[model samples]
Target: MNRYPTVLTIAGSDSGGGAGIQADLKTIAALGAYGTSAITALTAQNTQGVRAIHPVPPAFLQEQLEAVFEDITVDAVKIGMVNTVEVARVIADMLDRFKPGFVVFDPVMVSTSGSKLIQDETVAVLWQELFPRVDLITPNLDEAEILIGGQIRTPATMKGAAIQMVEKGCRAVLLKGGHLVGSTIYDVLAQSSQEPLILESDYIESRNVHGTGCTLSSAIATYVARGNSLAESIIFAKEYIAGAIRSGADVVTGYGPGPLNHSFSPVSMQIVS
Candidate 1:
């Protein structure tokens, strides 16, 4: 019997159903992969902002990871929004144990309000523990700035940051340049073995920009699970996210930023031998 290509998302939950675990599942399903999750925290949030966050106990989180890994054949993993040091450590440990074929980490270190979400110590721990375990790390401009302790104002700096992150132990880095002031968004993919690739897309003018990072990372994981190369997966994920944003541009889900239309182009669940 064949099994559906599965991508497990280790992230937080957003009650708004736009980002985090919600968006990850949506993207995985849309891209023809079965999705599983081990939630590290739950946030009371909406399109506007986060209100409160309740951490899942480390022991329970470990149990969730064990349960999924023991039963499911997770082909790829996408990680997001790990705020606490304890949660970060648990995820790193689980990755070491299960050794999933592909791992993508979206270093969600900053909030929409331009505030640091994780502490300095937690950041160090992520670099120490998780950076060496994952295949790719996707960080938006703000998060990249935080990680490198410098501003990224141009494409050159973005590429430089990606290289710096790869030197820090990530196998590859996708430095998202969506926050750059322009109509064309630039995402730089830098790997240790190849020349940096620049992916460009038109900036869709939409309030429905929430969950894009989660959605993109999940899509990449699904594509990788389905046997696409790392660069190919990133290309496909970028296209998928651009389409989702364009499709949901006019829809209104909340007064603030809304969500991408993840199902705009859906595929049947892919089966693997």
Candidate 2:
């Protein structure tokens, strides 16, 4: 029997359609997977900045999760921007209950402007209840610093932070070095049992990178859902996002940082047995 390799994105909603649930769904679909969602919050924002956020109640979030998992065979899961501790707990419970095949968590703790998004309590809950359950935790430099309480200034420091996060309970860590200074970017992938793998790319100088993190993580889940190994999935996701960025670099969507061209070269929906 064949069915679409389904990926469920549990995250917030971005009215800008560049990040959170919007980006996740777009990335998943672009990578040839069936996309499902369980929205955790709603944000009013554009390429410039976020103005407000409306969180979904924890119970309602649980209902959303159940509605999808009860019927669909979610081949993978991508989690982003869980603002409240209660919402984090609800998502943690669902993951425990469903035990999905693959879980990629993008710890969206800091904003583009360097403001903290999740509370300290919510961060604690993520570490205690969710980190162990996720297969990979993708944290940009800012989020990684918050998680580990240190600075990541170079690829070497990024490696150290990724290892520290793995030691703190994460099954694996992908510490993004996009925020680091340079034309070349480094993303370090680390686990307790294996040496860290440093993935590098020539950073594209573009303001249209509002949803790169969300897109990368969701693409990772989509590839894994399509039967790629975790390492292979990360590599493929890196290539996909690069193309998306380059494809949309010149197109202006808003006054500030625009979004990637997610459908630059989308694949057909993939089938798996």
Candidate 3:
């Protein structure tokens, strides 16, 4: 029997099941990887907005990480929504210790409703410690603006921000341009020593895009686990997310924004012979 490549997600839990660990796991499974999780926090959230948030203890978080790392063969990791500086630090420490093969950091500092998820103090910790440890960091335009302490309004600015993130020790940066106002959505993937690649998609007009960032990052991590190159991973992940968005557009899950169709089809895990 062949063992499937395993992907782990360390993220907050979204009660609505649209974003956070729920979305990450869904995307991972949909992309044909075994999904595991170490939840950082729990939020009372829905399509409308976040109602309340309760962070898990750092010690418990560590335990979760250790438990998963000790037993499961984690092929890749997708980290999201470390809500505090200590949580971020803990995750960074674990990453340093274990050094998972492929790590995707979805720097989830804000919600789709434009509310801050992580605190200001944690931002420095994330930049100093967590930023350098991961294989790829996926930050949307708003999160990128917060990271670089400046505005990112254009494609040039996005590329500059990605380069700045690369300089900050991130191996590569996938700066998402979904929030930008336009018909064409451009996602810039910039590596440390390579020429940056631009992935432009015809913007799918839809309201059901709540968990796009989480889904995209998780899908990319799954591809990486399955032995795809970073560029190839991003390309395939982009196509998958586009299809998800297109498929889930008319399905109403909530009064506000809904989630993408992560499991439109059961994608079999691709194992190298």
The lDDT values for all models are 0.90, 0.91, 0.91
TM-score of each: 0.97, 0.98, 0.97
lDDT of candidate 1 at residue 56, scale 0 to 100 = 92
Per-residue C-alpha lDDT of model 2 across residues 1-273, encoded as one tens digit per residue: 889999999998889999899999999888899999999988888888888888899999999999999999999999999889999999988988989989999988776745456878898888899999999999998888888889889899898889999988999999999988888999999988999999999989898999899999999999999999999999999999999999999999989889999999989997877
Off by over 4 Å in 2: none
The local distance difference test score of model 3 is 0.91
Model 1 ranges with Cα > 4 A deviation = 113-115
Give the winner by lDDT: 1 or 2.
Answer: 2
Q: What digit string (tens of lDDT, one per residue) describes model 1 on residues 1-273?
A: 899999999998999999999999999999999999999889888888888888899889999999999999999999998888999999989988988999999998776645455767888898899989999999999888888899898999999899998888889999999989888988999999789988888887887889889999999999999999998899899999989999999999988889989999999988888
* Model 3's TM-score against the true structure: 0.97
RMSD per candidate (Å) reads 1.1, 0.9, 1.2
- The weakest ten consecutive residues by lDDT in model 3 span 264-273
